[model samples]
Target chain A: MNHEKNIIELKNITVRFDGETVLDNLNLTIRDGEFVTLLGSSGCGKTTTLRIIAGFLEPDEGEVFFDSKNMNGVPAHKREVNTIFQRYALFPHYNVYDNVAYGLKVRHVPKDEIRERVMEMLRLVNLEGFAKRSVAKLSGGQQQRVAIARALVLKPKVLLLDEPLSALDAKLRKDMQVELRNIQQATGITFIFVTHDQEEALSMSDTVVVMNEGRVQQIGAPEDIYNEPQNAFVADFIGESNILDGIMKEDFTAQFSGHTFRCVDRGFAPGEAVDIVVRPEDVDIVKPEDGMLKGTVTSVTFLGVHYEIIVDIGGFKWMIQTTDYAGVGETVGLSIDPDAIHVMKKSKYSGLYGDYSTFSDEMEEMNQMSEELAEEYAEELAAERTEEAGDGAEEAGK
Target chain B: MKNRTFLRRIIGAPYVLWAAIFIVIPLLIVVYYSFTGPDGSFTLDNMKNLSDYGQIFKISILYSIAATVISLILAYPFAYVMSRKKEKTQQIMMVLVMLPMWMSLLILTYSWMNILERQGIINTLLGKLGHAPLNLIGTPAAVIFGMVYNYIPYMILPIYSVMSKIDPSVLEAAEDLGSGSFSKLYRVILPLSMPGVVSGITMVFVPSVSTFYISQKLGDGKILLVGDVIERQIQAQNNYNMGAALSLVLMVLIVLSLALMKLFAGESDENLYV
Candidate 1:
């Protein structure tokens, strides 16, 4: 965390495709030897930012500076950066050693030196005995390590990884996360990782950058980002939270759900509308008579570590994670401390998320089904277009 | 399940019968005719006579090899450019390449004859421009040009399909790893496209070597290829024995050449379809 002296700076970057803006006017800076992650859902411009830093893409309306030098018009090969593509992109024709040594061989490095460096990189990625093995035969996790070794063998000043662990199974993904963090630390090269998985970002990154709709929502350490979210989007995206419309009454006081509560956040005008974020694990279950607000328990699910209960509070559903057992028909009370309630200013994302009324295990399945359906629909459209073009070719030939 | 198996056998009966009648029977007849004389007695006279047509075999091989090489040189760059184009443009280019193929080969060669003849369209244009008429028709070059024009599509289609299937991310990865344009092509693209090159060479070489019409129409009876000699023996001279023997030798030659090509393209054979 003692990082200083910016290594990469992006100034007012904007990118557009097909007359639609993919990345808005954005600005960011990376320090030396810092593990930074751009976390967002799909189509949120996270990969676009990584491409800009890797020199594969040039911003339409901004300047990029690497090591305090303007990097405009510089090609990817000439830049002191390497990227691990989303699919690993290992050369199928080459073995592991040849793939890792490709960059050095292209630069006409000595054959013996190439072999030595390639073997060292193989040892780093734990693929020392796989030098002569073909890349196509390796499993997904092994291929990912080969990609990492190939990029790091160049010894670039920066490494950009675009969702490198996304293709692995869950257990393998976790193992690789720890391995990647260790590799980044050992190499001390500035690592810029992009992924849509917030948990991965939180666990691996020294600095987490939350993005939404092509704009930066918040940027801070993982703890700060989790404990102190700036808006409803960050709070809901990071973890489960009960977001409600509240009003700031005065200094250190907020009014929401027909109860006035004391919170730590301040510096707001009197009687201003704001959003309140209460984490599911922060509140404590207690007796109904001693509770600040009373609620009826609607549903309870047995998770491994805790029980997740949904309560109806003044016709609004609130999700609570607690270790105590609560029946579906029982009325429960909840209590919160002053430090537990987080208040945020109203933003464009307010009232859009953080509602548990439609929350269920079935909802997640339905969302997955719809996503698959949408992908199938898109594939059908592409197939139809290709068929039509083929018919046109036949007709023109006649 | 038993009924389904019976039905499958019934459906495949026609193909088996057709192969017996048209393919297997004709091949047996060819083998029989190659070993017998006109008097219906086994003899090696026809096989021994093959040495007399050695010069014709050499000329045929030389002309077809030239045709195959020229077609490859012309089609490789064209297919590479087409593969790099957008989908719409690529489809249009494919149509243009196949357009010349839909017409009859005789008609296409006849049209080339009209274009390349001394007193034809080119000569007429040259006469108008006050330049001497260049002799183009009835030359070895004309026959080779005709073979190349007729078979170039076969060379282009396979190469283009293979090149277009290359994952674009692999190229970007090469660029990211400090490879320039030429290096990327030499190291990655050329090796990956070897399967297509082999298939294209085979497609062009097979037909040009055994072609009778192109050399007959464009060579104007001067360039006697193996196909023309075989046609003369079987149809005009009624010498089926010599024609069948010549066909057997030609088949052996083609098979040997294909085996050589497969040896050169050793491990890439696994991904030939891919």
Candidate 2:
């Protein structure tokens, strides 16, 4: 990104909290007027990144620059940036008008201008008539809107929101997510929002930076992140992915799970082991003989418009989606396009034991143990029901 | 259920009856006496008599108000520092504030007497600075100073309690909104901690009004507050009816002062009570 378009650049930032490194050598460039979301699961340091940008936490290793200005020693209050906290920290003593007018008042804007700006901001949030109402009297969504209005009224170059809608109910959260995106676009300010919900991030952000364990996993547009994940973590964290371990055979053919398949994602040495990730919706169900792989249908689920099928292919369970009917215990065929097969270099963090062969052996043993535990629990439940029935029968006879 | 509730009420009735007898009945008696005359005749003479009592009442009110105000001004910073400091420091400071509270009022008054007297350490130090012994004892200032010193912890504790409950996030939010430190103090900290301020004022004022011991002791038996007047009328002069009427009048004044304070302090009293 060009320096003019990029409002903030954080390079090689590292943060350690009580000897535990929370953010480690992270670099990110936030462009101007773009709604970028730091999307990740819990313990992902996404919140820490937002806090660091807000100047609440200082990095131990690197520098943060905002519009070519260094932000090394600037306190949060002195920074040009404004933050909307998760709790919507509205001044409880101030009503809606005063709360909205707070920043302008601090700036010593003329009274008439403060009034006009607050009124204009309130109208933007559709809270025009609520000037005299106490902030405590507003609903959760209203308070969040007021918080955003307050931050925006300051005309800050960068607006940082730390899970602003996480406190609302599901329906309200969804509504505010749309409202927030519209507000950001209309205001044309850089929005650095933090959220643990992948769905929210994917739906609202122009760009999503996925993070995990104090590191950036991937940074891309929603479609790019969803369609072409860079690694197993990105593929697994963003959405449901079925991974199959395979080996390249120098002829563009991959072998795995008792089947051979062609792959288009090349540039790998022959005999190199790789993990192939295929979305459940990408799997094609066809005739048993025509399919590249055959499996027994273990379960079929009707989820609104789509049908989800769980197939057991030679003791390896794979989730597949198909519109066709596949009953339990019936053998089915599954096929995938070579282009749809995403190949990732197997990672060390997957905790796979020893070599790939040992990994497969351990997986089989784990599956057997799980099955035996389930059978044992099921028999115990049956025995309890039988004893209760016997007691009822004896009482009836008596 | 009705019988069980009745039984529970019966078991708890003695404490309630005791409260009514000791607290409510005496307050009612004070009210009654304030309305009666010296000759056992029902009249508002005691309430309206204010000729001798008026000047004394004014002096008493002025001295007490001044003392309470000064005490609050002095106690706030001390209480704030104590409340904001580390746990061990706060505890030690609190114990020091509470030491005067644990000591008897009469003993503390004598201690003040020794400190404020002509040949006391303060005067001796001033004399060492090439000045004559300054007059401090046997004055209204001494009386006010004694009351304030004795009752300062009463002011500090309630205010500290209120200040400690104020969420630090509220102040940070104010700062984030671009409020300077002074504005944040005036808007957020002061208003949010009003309950403590109001309660501290009440704690200082109510007792200081009828506090005759420090006045009589420190004033060298010359200053006569309402409490002193009532004590003298009943014990020294042997005029029980006049004493009762004066006591009743004093009670009414205290109640009115409290009501006025509440009305002025605005909506925070109910929150503190709850």
- Using alpha carbons, what is the TM-score of model 2? 0.80
Over A274-377, each residue of candidate 2 has an lDDT whose tens digit, in order, gives 87788888889998998989989888889877787888887667887677778888888888898778877788544232122212455878889999999999
For model 1, residues B68-143, the per-residue Cα lDDT tens digits are 9999889988988998898999999999999999999999999998998888899999999999998888899999
Q: Taking the tens digit of each residue's C-alpha lDDT, what string does model 2 give over B1-274?
A: 9999999999999999999999999878777766776666788666566466888888888988998999989988787777778789888988998988998999999988888888887898998999989788989899999889988898999888877776655566677777767887787777777878888888898888888798988897878787788788888988666677777667778888778877977764433321
- CAPRI tier for the interface of model 1: acceptable
- Candidate DockQ values, in order, are 0.42, 0.31
Global Cα lDDT for candidate 1: 0.91
Candidate with best lDDT: 1
A-chain TM-score, model 1 = 0.90
In order of appearance, the predictions have TM-scores of: 0.90, 0.80
Q: Which stretches of model 1 miss by more than 4 angstroms?
A: A359-398, B1-21, B270-274
Question: Could you list the chain B TM-scores for each candidate?
Answer: 0.93, 0.88
Q: If you score just chain A, what TM-score does every candidate get?
A: 0.90, 0.86
Candidate 1 residue pairs in backbone clash: none
